[model samples]
Target: MPAKVGAVKVNNVGNSSVFNIGDVYSMSPESTAKTYAGGGSFITGDGIRIRLGQSTTYVTDKDKLDQNIT
Candidate 1:
């Protein structure tokens, strides 16, 4: 019904983030990131050259009700 907060301090808040000091119904944070790195190359038998690269994906939420789909 009521909330009381004393001295508070915050350092930082990132994108798609939430900071609650009091009561709340709900909170959802979503984020997606992709990265790639390569240091080598390869050639196919058909004489086609291809570069090899490593990749990674990070997702906070695959499906969020706030956005419907992710």
Candidate 2:
């Protein structure tokens, strides 16, 4: 059996490249990994943003996937 823990946030922007998940997350516009379409905005309560036209690829690759073994 596997127990679910924590939460994940997915960004559906077009070209943005910012993804954040967990209890507490924060990012500044100047230090953002990629540039957003219109502008970067924070997600309510989650303290994350993916910009206007960015998309999330959090776990699309197997080599970079984060697996939990308990």
lDDT, residue 29, candidate 1: 76
* Model 1 error, position 37 (Å): 4.5
Q: Candidate 1, which segments miss by more than 4 Å at Cα? A: 37-70
Q: Evaluated with lDDT, which candidate comes out highest? A: 1
Query: Which digits, one per residue and each the tens of the lDDT, describe model 1 over residues 1-70?
Result: 8799999999998777889998888887777654343343222376565644664444465654443435
Model 2 segments beyond 4 Å from truth?
Answer: 1-13, 30-70
Model 1: worst 10 consecutive residues (lDDT sum): 35-44
Write down the lDDT that model 2 would get: 0.46
* RMSD of every prediction: 11.3, 17.6
Q: Which candidate has the highest TM-score of all?
A: 1
